[model samples]
Target: MLFISAITFGADYDSIGDSTIVRKRSDLTQKLYDTLLSIKGNGIFFGMQHATGYGVGWQNNNDSCDIEKVTGDYPAFAGWGASVTDCNIAQGEGFEDARYKIKLFHDMGGFNTMEWHADNPFGGNCYWERRHDKTKDVVASILPGGEKHQEFLTQLDNIASFFNSLIDDDGKKIPIIFRPWHEHTGAWFWWGKGNCSKEDYISLWQFTVNYLSDEKGVDNLLYAYSPAKNDSREEYLYGYPGDEYIDVLGQDNYYDLRQDATNMPRFVKMLETLVSIANEKNKPAALTETGAFTIDAKATMPEDNWFTEKLLKLIMYNDKTRQISYAMVWRNGSTSHFHVPYPGHPAVPDFIDFYNHPYTIFMSDMEKYRTKNE
Candidate 1:
């Protein structure tokens, strides 16, 4: 089978030297295109750093929701969102049994990240507590230490196999959006803050995609490249393995750290840059994860809602960027250290307007996409 590789985003098309691009009529794969062109974002996309599923281990009865409740909210994606978490651990049950209910959720029609493990990327727990210790070996599984080139490939292989076990909302192979090491530019977590080099990071991302797509049978995945919308457009902003290796180009930002408000423009400009790149290369843009750090009780801050409402509007109208497809919520509201968005807050109102709003006009454009592509 022939393959056209866009090694680096927006690289010159004619000269294919260090890069790879195999052009043939039928070379494009359905899964590959899904990553690059298809698979629009779920607007009310909510993420759970620590899900209630972990309560399954203790039979504690607090795993975030009742099976009945989730079942009732099954396809109520109107304003309701889906949960994605690290570990995918079942607190009351074993990994296997916990995963079974997880599959059941999707069997009824739902979507989730089936995420790789994380140590509270934006600060919070995945399964209530730390979920699991910093078992980077169990989670990241990178070689303890070795040459950056050799180690990157080895660890990538391990991460792919771990995530491949999941099923999608159809109870079939889970077409998960695997987002491993994200927001490397931020100095917040262990993964960033000079913990790893750029070459090391890029190699890991590329190798993971190759292993999953070519080695493992996980063709149902769209690897997401996410970064905390940083103030400066630092080098880490675009540190990807190229369009071929990455399925989606994404960014993650929040109103938690600063109330100064200047970060908003930085976010808009950075997203504009990323979306432009994705659009030029036939890839779509996504706000993979975002949220405010604090939500007051009873009183929903209209001020906070303004933040939610305005940022969303900017993503849609920005001229230099691609059409912003998904604006997800980083739903880890329980953590005290750092977190802004969570459930039951007025600011995080039902965003059904994405489909209903005249600004987005999503359904109409979707029809155009379906017709033009099909």
Candidate 2:
């Protein structure tokens, strides 16, 4: 499979990379970047995680989504997870389902992003498993010359195989934003700040990118570096793998915007810094993951209009922050643990208002941004 360069698209591809990373990027991948760059400064695209797979009061139903159920349209961006793609047979079934959903969304002119909550490689239960008194340095162990190095390569191979399998009806590859090791600034995951040294973390990120792009020949991807929320820009770029390896700068913030809407100024400050850094580096930025856990099993929302008054206000606060490419809420797991409002929910009217606002883009408004190949 010989991939062609994106010279015909008239994109400033050099700005995206100065190495082989951009050279091997597919034409659709470059077009996606151009599309996102054109969208910046105009409007922010709304997105949802695991949007079509399941939703509140539904599971694996065909052609249905919670956002569409409420807003009469689907989100412009759809997020998926690849945590169990390389796991056992029972777990790998989820990856197969994701492949179908990804292709379906792509065919509808919706953009896609993927994250990995990869299980801990060193005998731990899940990705959240931390290295304590009885565990090894997981990040170090998966690097170039450690004991679990071969196992890590096998995992990457599985992911690469999955990436290669995403094809359109015309048999062209579908481009997606691959975000791995997200929210690493927190101490909850195995790859968090305290669990791994800064050098080891950097090595792990660069190695993963190199392995997928160079060794495995996976070209239909745009890499994104997303860290947890940070007070200063320095904290956000703690273990950044350099501009050559990253195409987007993202931040996963749930505390300031969701926990207490009154603390919105902190989120605004972080957004300002994020957009500024993205501008300086010539890359797109996004609010990777965020949503008020209002309709949870144990708690209900204090305010009825959290979407318009809280989430939308945080993004539309200033011109710079509004330039963010997209803002995605979490998934709609069930009636109790959903992020977006479902049918008959009190937040429906306010969410509709947010959808009707010119600054917010959904799938219905994405026709103008379609690529030539698409």
Residue pair clashes in candidate 2:
none
Q: What TM-score does each of the candidates earn?
A: 0.62, 0.90
Q: Residue by residue across 88-108, what tens digits does model 1's lDDT show? A: 331211445445544543443
Scanning candidate 1 in windows of ten residues, the lowest lDDT window is 74-83
Task: Please count the clashing residue pairs in each candidate, in the order shown.
Answer: 23, 0
Quote model 1's TM-score. Answer: 0.62
lDDT of 2 by residue, 181-277 (tens): 8888887888889888998998988889878987988999988888998889889899987776778889898777654456678889988999999
- CA displacement after TM-score superposition, residue 281 of candidate 2 (Å): 1.0
| Residue 193 CA displacement from its true place in model 2, Å | 0.4
